[model samples]
Target chain A: MLKINNLSATVDDGNKTILEALSLEVPAGEVHAIMGPNGAGKSTLSYVLTGRDGYDVTSGDVTLDGDDLLEMDPEERAAKGMFLSFQYPLEIPGVPTMTFLKTALNAQRRARGEEEMAAPEFLKKARALAKELKMKPEMLKRPLNVGFSGGEKKRMEIFQMMMLEPRFILMDETDSGLDVDALRIVADGVNKLRSPDRGMLIITHYQRLLDYIVPDRVHVLSGGKIAASGDADFAKKLEAEGYDAYAA
Target chain B: MTHMPLKLENLPTRRDEAWKWTDVRGRVSETSAGLSVAGLPKFTLPDGITVSEVETDDLDTDSAMAKLARNFGGKVWAVSVPEGFSSDTPLIIEGLNRGHIRIRIDIAKGASLSVIEHHAGDAGGFVNVDMTVTLKAEAKFDRTIVHNDPADCVRIATAHITAWNDAAVTQHALSFGGALSRIETRLAGMGKHIEATLNGAYLLDDKRHCDMTSYIDLAVPDCTIRQAVKGVVTDKSRGVFQGKFHVRRPAQHTDAEMRHDALMLSDTSEIRSKPELEIYADDVACAHGNTIGQLDESALFYMRQRGIPLAEARALLTEAFVADVFDDLDDEDLRESLLGKIREWLKEG
Candidate 1:
């Protein structure tokens, strides 16, 4: 389970508050979606949850599986099964995709007191995952996201999620630059990882992504707070009617 | 002039324009011990090549270090490659540990040769070397310099090269710095249609210092030159790069580009880069670029978010930043070996 209670955050060295008294919860085996318009503090919430620097949490409490998530470093949070698929994936030149994957996986495993995966076994698992995602084997040999297209970067993020197998996943605008076919492929990859032991928090601006990956609950975030909450049908209502009614 | 043992005062100080960044006189003293004053370096010559000693005190350059080598080094070892001669194996020169050494290489017309020179010195020693290379028409020369000196050694190595028309020259250098070290090269092209490439990389740590300087003179038309150098410094260490391309008025069709990029890992680490292009011809294409920066923060965060630790993330990013300098090497084993050294340095940092 993941919980955020009265979470308020200030960005740019506390010059301005982006998240204000925000409260939410996502239980295991459930998928929750947060829908909001521009300047609704949607991305800031995700960044705060993942422990990115430069975001000061003035007053709030965030926990995963009853453990304090706010006190841990970003890597520690990641090792504790917190994953955030960035809205704009960064380009890391010179680090091969395969090498990056291995380093990430081994680090997480070591942090959890598990033995490192064997080379052959790791390669076998990676090759199988790449095949399932319809990614070329040669793509794994290139530098990580150095020259990859938007769609390819999204797919690579999902590929990493599958390989890491985190307990909680946060997808931040994963469908922004993807096309219809590419969106479908990314959706398929995400849906395959859904299980009763994992929790997911999907943040999107449009209901189009909801059509492919249905959510159990939906919340309308406005002015750094949740103005309304309902079932999946609420997403359709928000889509039909703009956020003007929910504005703070 | 009489032949006398060179004194410590003969070193250049920061007052010299060319040695401003690398002050050899400011660091060494008369009481510096463990000075290895030895004879010439051992060379493993391949077939079609011969080495003979010649007594010579006529140095060509005005460089302070080269003059020290000329005055201290009694004779110069001349290595000659006959006309139309070619070899599959590379001639290897053992590491220069101490003393002053002078060498000259001559590649006759239509001849080709490759040389690998290693520089590793003893503790508290000051090593100086002066080398000259002459290439005739259609001659090909490939030179690789590898420097891994002791942490307390002060060393300087200079090479002067002359190439004729239709000659091809390639030089690659990798240096793991010492207390204070400098590798300098001067190339003069005398004919048209010549091709030259100069690429190098340096890694420094633990207060070590290294300076890589090169000056290319293109005096004729239809000459092309390319130079790129990458450097990484950590733990209060310093790295320097000085590159210049001088194109004369007669070299109308000349094309040249020079670039120097460096990465500073620690706040205390320093890097000085200067890339210059002095072109007298208006129709030529010449460009120079220099950059000194830290690793990308966004890229570092991305790697860490994937569960890599801070140190490992930094190492991976740095290794990538300097890996492209050796991309054009023809030997796979040699490339891997060079990468191995980089990886080792990254781990230690």
Candidate 2:
């Protein structure tokens, strides 16, 4: 479970307050969706929670499974079972996907005081996961997202989420720019990887992604903080109604 | 032997066939002839892999061939690659005169060898370092040459690799130094199947110039050659890469790929790449690519978003850009050393 308390952050240097004293928590065994209109800081909130830089933490405390997530390094946060599927992931050429996945997974394993997985074991698990996700085998050979299309990039992020088996994941608009079929495939991959001990925060701009990976709670964000919170039905109402009233 | 005179005729300079772009004739001080090699630093690798020298001018003075013997006179180094030689022992051969340093390596057919020739001296100095690698048919040679010498330094390092049937030669050259440094590599592949990869990385700063001109000759069948050169230039520094993969008619089923990618860190920095493939036969899959530009701003923004400071991000990207050249280097110790030097350079740049 992830706990966030009194989070207020600003886009560094500028007096721009992206998150104005927002606070929310996602309990274990549940999916929390954050939806908002343009410039509502939905992505900023996700970034802030993940401890991404640029957003100066005006005042905040974020904890994962009772451990302070804000104080940890990016890799350390990752080792503690936290994942973020970025809206625009990096394209690392010449560094194969398998190498990246193995490095990240091994780093986590090392942090947890576990024996490093051998190359053979790593390959076996990766191949099996790719097959379940319907990922092309050739993808594992290429550089991480080097020449991947938009849909493939999203799919690769979910694939990492599955492979790492993160205890908590922040999907920052993982559905953006994806076609319906591609979105369905990605959502299915995320759905299959979900577990009772894991929690997720799916950040999105549209209501369509909520249909596949239904959230237990839907929060409407406006001006950085949560403006409205409700059950799954709130998503349908917003889809039919739009966030015009929330902005007001 | 050519006398070590202050004014020697036909001095090798920028006008020579090998050193056309870098002229070092008017640079060397007259006091250089007396400069002692005794004070040169020595490096001891972690393992007991100590480097010893052998002289050929004592044994076969007349039998010495071409440039190796002409400048080499009687000096030759027969480096003994200890059995199961697997450490990252980078043999350093710095502080050289216009004379040559020819090292003949006997890497037992299946053995692995990583030879790193590092150059560092005064500006306007002409140094020729030649290394002959004969992989007895099945040996693996991961050779690397790092040239971080002073600007106006003219350097011609020739590496002749003969990978007899089924041998692999992963040849890497990092030329971050030199006013005009060029690495020319000539490889003969396939006594069976040789995997010859020729890669170069240069970081140009303050009008420094570099060139990696190589020729890969695939005389036999089933040989694969992959050549990639990446550079980062600042100020008015220039980077040039001219690579040619000649696949003869007898060399069938050859797979050769040559890629040149460079990043200009400053507005005045320039890069010129010509990747040529001259194939006399049709049964080969060969491709060449050249990309010259700056770092991707989006990637920079992304890394900055992750809280890695901008300077650190640039260093990391620069490292990652050139790190591919050493990805296949068989020696772990040598790889780490090269990476360390590159990281240091990135920090300052």
Candidate 3:
């Protein structure tokens, strides 16, 4: 459902190129994991796809369901069914988690000519989802991610992903800073979102996360391009070995 | 005191450091021609409070504006809360026209009260208000003053407060600037173990100007004072905040902190802040902070990425920036009302 063809991007006002003609595709009903070493443009790929500022896309194209995604604003892309679970979720002070969720949900709905959800219905759904995610109702009342622990932040990110129910999901280093228990809970949340109609791109440096939410296809990212493509066993091989051989 | 004639020209000019940013003299000279005193709205006191109109020639002629108010023959209104009485309902005082008003409030010993004074009018004139509040020993008092004047109107308000031993006083003021608006406060901690909080916010747009100036005196031992003032300026609006904390020699264990933060929503918007501490006590804690900047860009982007439009994200973040000023307020309805007003103001642009 999501395709990136020869995507070349730069950093620092084009002073440095992070992604050099990188190409990848994740079809609907498939979960693709991009494993790479440090400075291999893993995070850069997510940011570029999400249209974050300062990461200029110098060439190539990205499309979702045959619609051009690069031409839309970040929020427009969000309304077009693109979701990014930030590696370090921003602590937005003053915007309560519930309010943020409702706004996001309604914004996407409104963009698609759908009626806004009533407060009661939205709260009911949010409370249920929050419970299933093991988040306290009180946490939803606090500011988004403010004062949240590392695990809580990761869980909240997944909570948002589940609530938004986007068509394409981008997980950037979702395993980092998570303990074994938190890893399981987060993996369960992601696993529940797996469906035949949605596509996911899991970007990570380690194979520990793959053991929980195993990917259908694994791609080794080296020097901004896909160096090797394999099945689920490739992640285990990288974990036992390392990215040193792929660096060359 | 000398009976000098009150003249608009005698108002503090921009050359004076305290009035430099506000330019009150210039604004008065330009807008004082049509100034007149119109009828005032009737005030209804809440439970546990009494109001009486006192006929007295005694007036505080401390400044040119005060002298002008005295010359207008304004009646003195005294409001008092009896000793040992406490009430949850706040006294609501509304100002609806251009006039000179003098009010004195007495919170008797062991009494507690909350007062909300709202000022709004459509008259294209000026209003001068002088208020004095006395909190007796062990008394508690909270006051919030909100100004929503028309664009052509001008408001000059001054308040003097005295807190006795073990008394606690909190004052919050929010001003949506008119053509020219200023609120000056002089507060004193008269006895030991007093606590005082002074918080204010100003939202100005277009060519409006608002000035909040205060001088607080910690005269007795073991008193604490907290002051926070925030402002948002847009278009050609101007915001000024000047606060001074004085710790006397007898106030040995006094603690005071003052912070002033402003958000400039437009390049032409101006904010001038001065927080000064004058201490004669050797064992006192006093500090001040001032900052002026725009909203955080990262926070804005983060909100937008979550599907919130850019404008709405900006408004939410700006509202949050100034939300802490009202944290100490206990009235939920009033706090919501004030926040609603802030959101309305943010949506105006």
For all candidates, what are the clash counts? 0, 8, 0
Q: What is the TM-score of each candidate against the true structure?
A: 0.96, 0.62, 0.93
Backbone clash tally (model 2): 8
Indicate the TM-score of model 1.
0.96
Instruction: Report the error of model 3 at residue B309, Å.
Output: 1.4
lDDT of 2: 0.73
Docking class of 1: high
User: Which candidate has the highest DockQ of all?
Assistant: 1
* Model number 3 iRMSD: 1.2
Best by TM-score: 1
- Residue-level error in angstroms, candidate 2, position A15: 4.5
- Give fnat (model 2): 0.09
Minimum summed lDDT over a 10-residue window in model 1 chain B is located at B30-39
In model 3, the Cα lDDT at residue B53 comes to 78
- Identify the superior model by DockQ, candidate 1 or candidate 2: 1
Q: List DockQ, one per candidate, in order.
A: 0.83, 0.10, 0.66
Best by the lDDT measure: 1
Overall lDDT per candidate, in order of appearance = 0.89, 0.73, 0.86
Docking class of 2: incorrect
**Model 1 Cα RMSD, Å?**
2.0
Output the worst ten-in-a-row residue range by lDDT, candidate 3 chain A.
A239-248
RMSD, each candidate, Å? 2.0, 8.5, 2.6
